[model samples]
Target: MGHFVIPVTGKPVDYVAQIFPKNNLIDHGVIVENAEVYRQANSDKIKVYG
Candidate 1:
């Protein structure tokens, strides 16, 4: 799980955001923005999950 601090426009509240497992998977495991997009963009190299 990843944690992020988001700053609001005016409020003094501490807004936080959590990136889900699927979203975190991208650019991390495969270094791709999106699986399908990456696949369509790159056909020469096959996408494999580690």
Candidate 2:
């Protein structure tokens, strides 16, 4: 959630993969095009992992 791509912004973000580390919040809450990949236990309340 650091400085990164804004969906409404019409600018290109070339360093998206570097913006956030690979974590459950970004995995499940985002990437709406592929829901199945994000599906997993405790994804909704990710504090369980925190």
Candidate 3:
């Protein structure tokens, strides 16, 4: 599995609030956000890695 990281400009509580509507848990939201950011930040990397 690949690893991804998302930089959120807020505390965990704040990020959890923003993520609740889109996911069931804070960790899931973080993963989703990280995946998106990773895709945007390194499309070429994904292409090569995948």
Query: How high is each candidate's TM-score?
Result: 0.17, 0.18, 0.20
Top candidate when judged by lDDT against the true structure: 3
Candidate 2 segments whose C-alpha is farther than 4 A from its true place: 1-11, 22-25, 28-50
Backbone clash pairs in model 3 (N, Cα, C under 3 Å; residues 3+ apart or in different chains), count: 0
Write candidate 3's Cα lDDT for 17-48 as tens digits: 44434643323223224333322232222211
Off by over 4 Å in 3: 3-7, 15-50
TM-score of structure candidate 3: 0.20
Candidate 1 vs candidate 3: the TM-score winner is: 3
Local accuracy by lDDT, each model: 0.27, 0.28, 0.33
Ranking by lDDT: 3, 2, 1
Model 1 Cα lDDT, one tens digit per residue, 1-42: 674422222221111122224354322222233322222221
Per-residue error at 23 for model 1, in Å?
25
Off by over 4 Å in 1: 11-50
Model 1, TM vs. native: 0.17
Task: Estimate, for each residue in 1-50, the C-alpha lDDT of model 2 and write its tens digit.
Answer: 46433222122232223333543234223222222222132244312111
- TM-score (C-alpha) between model 2 and the true structure: 0.18
Q: What is the number of backbone collisions in each predicted candidate, taken in the order shown? A: 0, 0, 0
Error of 1 at 46 (Å): 35
